[model samples]
Target: MTGAIGKPTPYIDAVQKVTGQAMYADDYKFPNMVYVSCLRSTESHAKIKSLELKKAEASPGVVAIVTGKDIPVPFGVLSISRDETAMAIEKVRYQGEIVAAVAAETIEAAEAGVKLINVEYEPLTEFFTPQDSLKTCTPDEQIHAHTKDHKNIHKTAELRFNEPEKELETAKHKQTGNFKFAGVTHGFTEPHSAVAMWNGDETLTIISATQVPHYLQKNLSKVLGLPLHKIQVKKPVLGGGFGGKSDPFPHEMIVSFLSKKIKRPVKCTFSREEVFITHHGRHPTEINMSLSCDDGGKITALDADIIIDGGAYGSFGVVTSYYNGVLLQGPYLIDKFGFRTRRTYTNKHQCGAMRGHG
Candidate 1:
């Protein structure tokens, strides 16, 4: 109690929230605003054989229809791995990937339009786990073509100091462990939502419930081919991010593109199921850990090998590939230490930052 900086302080915005006076992204209203709904892919891994949108374009009250071809540029939170398109262009790496989007006068019309769009997919060999990805495969079979040696391995991070394996052999006590972890998602009450408006001067304004507005703005510029100055991103009262809303999502780009094309404000809000598909959460991992202790109970060495599941795209998997092993080096002292982490691309929701990042 003596070290407590202040006595039980209240959140500054708690009063407004309790009074129901706070504004979330979905709370905004505008004249002639349109609603958007996406047609997601049903296959885990597949090539787009064909996409027919005539029915959707002629759907009742439908105003705009956009697909991957409309916005081909890729965007992600990290620059090196911006591998996500606004919608599935050539292929979809995971189930529930957005393939097309519709904008209409009413939410019902948008939903109806989404169902009218027709798509044909050629199913490909899918890898669902890190073990499945590590196996040798044909170049065309790999999830990402750029990966070397025809493997699904996205990243492999290793660090070594003072030969931990040799040191552990000479220790008085040594313990080894194999741990498995399941994936987790942020289940916030308020779903993800965004509203995009194209100003008269060819500028764009986006209001979203996000934690990283600046990052979103930068990514929007990349995919939309608009200059940084032409796009303005605003973050509303976030119900909670927990790092889930930190990434620049495909839906954000989808809504903005439709708004500019139709010259009207477009709004998109996800259902709970859609939220799960856009997951950027902790990586599911299997870790092999070893620790050594001397006769005097002093720590001697530590070594770990981790294999993490990085579904679909590389969100924060690059950093996570290192963090799973590197973080163990801190807050403790060991004479010898080493670790290796291998991240594999899988056919599921891509993982990114989350609470603890474990």
Candidate 2:
């Protein structure tokens, strides 16, 4: 172990990747391959009044179009909160939520078909900040119906080891601070891509650039109404993940459903702009922390109040809410420690796992 510590270990696939021999999801092509383009919502928060896809169906080279009704099952990384549909269902919580999708002979035709679709939405009250999200809103204004007390709070994690607040008040030496951190994106080298093929034997095969294939397979079965054994998920050469690609994404399910609908290969590759819109990155957080120390310089007590802006759907937010508080327990022994983390839903791209778990 000591001898290998300073040695440079080359990546197993470094040669293949460097020589352009690595086959990525986008690089795979089939004989009857179709392309998919999604029609995203324009409003940050709105109820979809009407969706007209007749024009898109008649668009050049267009084969099929699917909305939320086609794949109605909801899915998320955590089973406790499966709130996201493959496409926007009754309402669009965020501006870029996928409302519908178009499958066509070519990528250009699919994109053109997407442009032809018309959707009508009734505007709703939007929550953009964690502070606003903490307040109770009307049932209609609430981002998710499941939220408690009509508030946009997704998860509230609280843990207490001892009386930290009491200890802080009595301690001679103590410090308190408030911090605000901006949200960050992964900005991986390659945008997301997926290729789905419906085999003649009534099986489904999906090649995607993702880090969690098992979760993707499970979600695909749930959304597509197929048995686990009948579905196969393959991971090709991924450009980068950094925990951003850990969730089973909507685009992956969109392409899979489209392929099964038309019984041909279907592919969807996100543009650079789409990549940013599909962000599952580090959360925008606000924290108020207090700590106490004795004259001996050993930590006595610690406490924190944290708020994380979890935009739109609940991805891995439940776990993230817990991680934000529990992670502080390590690397130090503070007998009295307490924390409360509130994850709030907002009108923006969803935040999830990143380089750091929380």
Candidate 3:
């Protein structure tokens, strides 16, 4: 069983996964387990006015009700942008952002609790595209406070070598084009699911369908205020992440927090439609690309300016912003190259890594 670098090799766990013998996160069961349901915001962008949980707390079979205030700390895959909480805090930047969660004896009870919870919101201006973000607005209108001068821009990545503009002007042959790409979501086979339990010794365990268990472990420690040794993140047989499950999800944090508070196992699973709402797929982009060549058709210079929409939270947007320009450095030889990529915040599902990042 020897193979060269380019030769095909069998995946180590292909047999177990294909034969339906693999244990997925949802397959795990614990005694006295409770089901959790999350209440999501319906507004694209809004400030949270007030939340009423009296009805939800009194709902039949509802054991515990949690809100953003319970787990207020933010966590993201990238350290540069940790701006997502287990639930919406003072505001919700996207329509589907979770605002509340309930754990109950049965799934039906959890659903009932979800319907009982009431939320009041004051709608704010929404930025649906990169073009909208380029326009300056008041500080209160900006999606995030970090953006300077009331801008919605999340990141601006630039790289330059030599003088591409000067070379492009001297080149005899040149080609330029405009490109626009709509955002896309990963259509993984199985929806996201997780089961969390609190160990008797004040430790927590999370079994989830995730692509990066180590990342989740580190984030759980940060969000839960617990030591790394006190938390364990296990990735079970995954149906296919396609980079969608790479980030530590809010649902995972919600389940873990609820279980610890109630001293019982808590499980949260997403429906197919809900999975679409939790997208972190390809970024929607507007690009201007120019390539210059000599009379002999030899490559001279290349330049590009790209504007990408990074909705709601910055999942893997910082890396995505760099990859949009940096990945263009290739096997071909070129004397001059330049690129500028601006990733802006939009009021929608966030965009992150996918099959082809660039």
TM-score of each: 0.97, 0.98, 0.96
Candidate closest to the true structure, highest TM-score = 2
Candidate ordering by TM-score (highest first): 2, 1, 3
Give the runs in model 3 whose Cα sits over 4 Å from its true position. 3-15
**What tens-digit string does per-residue lDDT give for candidate 3 at 140-173?**
8999999876889999999999989988887789
User: Each model's C-alpha lDDT?
Assistant: 0.92, 0.94, 0.92
Q: How far is candidate 3 from the true structure (C-alpha RMSD, Å)?
A: 1.7
* CA displacement after TM-score superposition, residue 30 of candidate 1 (Å): 0.8
For candidate 3, list the clashing residue pairs, or say none: none
Report residue 256 deviation for candidate 2 (angstroms). 1.1
lDDT (tens digit, per residue) of candidate 1 on 217-239:
99999998999999999998999
Q: How accurate is candidate 1 locally (lDDT)?
A: 0.92
lDDT per residue as tens, model 2, 18-67: 99999988899999899999999999999999999999999999999999
Candidate 2: lDDT over CA atoms?
A: 0.94
- Model 1 residue pairs with clashes: none
